[model samples]
Target: MRLHRGGRLRWPTIGLAAVVGIGVLWHGRAAPALPTAEVKTGELVDFVELRGEVKAVKSVTLNAPSSTDGDLQIISILKNGTGVKTGENVVQLDTVKLQRTREQQQSDLKRAEAEIEGAQAQARLQEEQNRTELMQARYDVERARLDVQKQEILSAIEAGKTKLRLATAEQRAREAEQKLRSGRAAAAADIESKKQKRAKALFEVQRAQRGIESMTLKAPVDGMVTILPNWRGRFFGANAPEFKEGDRVWPGAPLVELPDLSAVRVAARVDEAERGQLSLGQTAVVRVDAVPDKEFTGTVSDISALAKIDFSTWPPPKNFDLALRVAQSDPRLRPGMSATARVAIDRVPGALLIPVAASFQKGGRTVSYVLRGARFEERTIEIARRNREQIAVARGLRAGEKVALRDPTEEASRR
Candidate 1:
């Protein structure tokens, strides 16, 4: 609209004219002579920065199996920190001695069985011989008894001889009966002894066979394999040696581990000062050092109730260990990878905020120098809350307004 002769500019119109006169300052402003920050409303997230490492949620451990052959010598083993799949061979123990023992035991078992069979046959033969001898002794006793009966018709001297022969035959019969009873029991005992030996040999053979079968160890889950430290290794020093080929381990000792990689977590340590800022179920973004291309989103799965002190430094700083359960577990994530986490402790949505440095107490009121057309106007502001870096403003500020970081009057005075 064009101005007419009768038109007059009011106070409000004058104010609008002055603002437009400043080169349309509302759309954009010229470079400020001093540092400044904008008053804007946005979502604010308080984060606790944590430095830690990536690890699996759970791990599968494989220990050296108990060996019956008295040998735990590892013939082959996967290297430490090697990735593996389920059912993959992890360690192969030396089975040569076990195989030899098994073969020897098996041979012994067969020999014992053969000996039992032979002894049983011998017992049966002895039993048959005993029965035949007993029958012959009874027949001899009966013949002698008949001779005694004929003594009544013989002469005196010949009758006495017949009677003596009958007595001798009776004594021999008793001896034969005793021998038959003793021999039968002895044969049965001998057979039983041989059978017991066979049973023992069979048990040994079974145990050796089991030991031979358990020689090769395989991965139980898909993960990274970390060889357990050999405390008795040849190179015993500050650092323990990792299990490898030709290493002799004790029976039932823990030898290797397969960490589960499907569900991964970040183990983080936070300073005690930041402990209160984190809680379970808070969201986090973790970046692994090895996998720099990915940022895995996760939730705070666990928080330590106790604190761990760092003794390497003076007046040790107490820290708490917490775990973050990753929502998207990339296959590339591995245990012990250095990870950094940004845990959102708290979130404020749609809050009007300004830099903490923008406002200061002046004349008993918190005030900031807000940008006016070609000038700075110091205005009193109401602050609802504040964090280390930002202050949430409850009043006296609007979005898109620039506030001076430092007093422009002070800058002019310094100049």
Candidate 2:
């Protein structure tokens, strides 16, 4: 009975060992393989992304003229953003002071005119006196000539008598001719002096007229009237001078901004490192945060030749700014919109492409898991073009080649 019991125990132990070995073999064969996808010839593009803001293509800031001062009072205010025609009154300074000044100037001008008239009268009187003197001198000269003729006849009659008489008559005639020439020169000088006085009075009147015109401020161009705030914080409250009515301003101070709506563009800043990859006329895909559902196409219109340096409280920062024009104009577009842009740098045609996820880095080279028969094998590939979504494999990949989409965990199980 003991021998029979021993035999039974041995058979059970052997049966258990065989079952354990078969279980291990079955588990190994049943382990799942890594996830995989096929590599195929397709098109791929490489691009760079940048954050930017939308702004008007053309904008001008209106400034106060240099001739304005704080003492100039604002008499009237045109509503902000009011469309105005050329030469329309945008701001009217308290012309009361200017009007008073002009009135005083007018009085002075009248005084000047009276003085000019008086000067003219004096000049005419001087000319008449000169003419009368000249005429009297002429008469004296004629009388001298007649006397000299009589003397000459007498000298001829008495020619055998006295030489002293002839000499005295000739001397008197010469003296009278000299007096007439002096009177004529004096008359001409008196007329010229009156003409000079009249010219000076006319100049004074014109100068006063210009001062009056300067007091009235008019719009220089056909655009909206935007008022700028005073620098002293006296006119528009304590807030920074952005826009307001009755703000005191100096000449050339920017008071308004006029944008040409016909042309619009998006101005964006690109990272300094990525600026080299961008160029004018490059196509871009833009997405505005305000309208996220819609995407717009644009072209790189302009690029800043220099990088921007931070001069504000936030200092020591730099970035290159770029401008892009929208492919189509939309009336809904406005300035100050936040946007994101992607510029294509390069593209490959008919290249072997695969999901970026499937590619892994190993041994200083990019690699992907190629599936062979029932198992995945690693292959080093040459990447030609790559973007955020896909990679173009230049070598070690072919059309219709199967590659793993995810890392292989089954390999660990096999090991």
Using TM-score as the measure, the top candidate is 1
Candidate 1 residue-wise lDDT, 1-415, digit = tens: 8787646846568888998887665446443487788999986667787888777788887888864435488899887778888888999988888888889999999999999899888888888888888888888889988887887788889889878888888887888889888998898888889989999999999888877767778887787787777877644224466888888888887888788787888888888889988899999888889998887898999999999986545677898889999898787776767898889877788999899899988879999989886678889999887766788888999999999998776776775
Which pairs clash in model 1?
none
Per-residue lDDT of 1-415 in model 2, one digit per residue for the tens? 4677469689888999999989877554532466667888887877888777776677655555455344554556676657777787766555565566556666766776676577667656765665666566566556555555555567565553344444544554555556556655655565456556546655655655665576556767676554554556644223445545565555566655555556767788776788899999998888888877789898999889899874322545687878889776555555556788888888788988899998988769888888776556778899888899898888988888889877665466567
Q: In model 1, which runs have C-alpha deviations exceeding 4 angstroms?
A: 1-39, 66-73, 79-88, 95-132, 148-178, 220-260, 268-279, 303-321, 353-398, 401-415
Candidate number of the best lDDT: 1
What is the alpha-carbon lDDT of model 1 when measured against the actual structure?
Answer: 0.83
Per-model tally of clashing residue pairs: 0, 5
lDDT of each: 0.83, 0.69
Q: Model 2 Cα displacement at 131 (Å)?
A: 2.2
Q: What lDDT score is found at residue 352 in candidate 2?
A: 87
Residue 268 lDDT, candidate 2, scale 0-100: 81
